[model samples]
Target: MALQDQPAYLIKMRAKPGLGDKLFALATEGMEKSGSSDRFIIAREDADPDVLWNMEVFRSHEAKDAYENSPLADELRDEIIELLAEPPMRIEVHPYSALPDGPA
Candidate 1:
């Protein structure tokens, strides 16, 4: 498949007041230990410290689906639900990939 059509998952999460740090720590830990994502982009909103945006890219939809249903993912999902100020929002995105002019 062409790079631009690659399937990915984009998530928007909001932590409870004063709990952004804890949420970030948990997410980082999970991403580091997990093989579900080939790329991860995580950012905290500057204006709203309680907001987090995450973009996770995988090799395929199958890989993404597998990771979402794993035991570790289930545990993390439960934990995140408790830490959230409101329900988390997620959407599937097709991203443009493969650096065209870069060394790669």
Candidate 2:
């Protein structure tokens, strides 16, 4: 599949008070090692310090699915759940266009 055909997601999370930084660090590390994403950006909500957001672009739907179902993901999820204030929200999106370099 082409890079423009990649799968992407917007994930919103609310970390327990005082645990936002930890959550962000853990999630960032996971993404860096996941091998499923070509690029991912993680951010914190300015209005709500405990709120976190992640935009991930994966090579393919299959790659994303495989990573999500893998034991590594499970381990990370288990760790993440303990620091979350609530369940995360995930929105799937399609990439319609990108710069010459590609989607960031």
lDDT of 1 by residue, 63-95 (tens): 778887899999998998899999889998887
- Go through the candidates in order and give each one's C-alpha lDDT: 0.84, 0.91
Q: Give the CA lDDT, 0 to 100, for residue 95 in model 2.
A: 69
TM-score of predicted model 1?
Answer: 0.87
Pick by TM-score: which candidate is best? 2
Off by over 4 Å in 2: 100-104
After superposition on all CA atoms, what RMSD does each candidate show versus the true structure? 2.4, 2.5
Task: Give stretches of model 1 more than 4 Å off.
Answer: 97-104
lDDT of 1 at 57: 78
lDDT of 2 by residue, 5-98 (tens): 8999999999999999999999999999899998888998999988989989998999999998999999999999999999999999866766
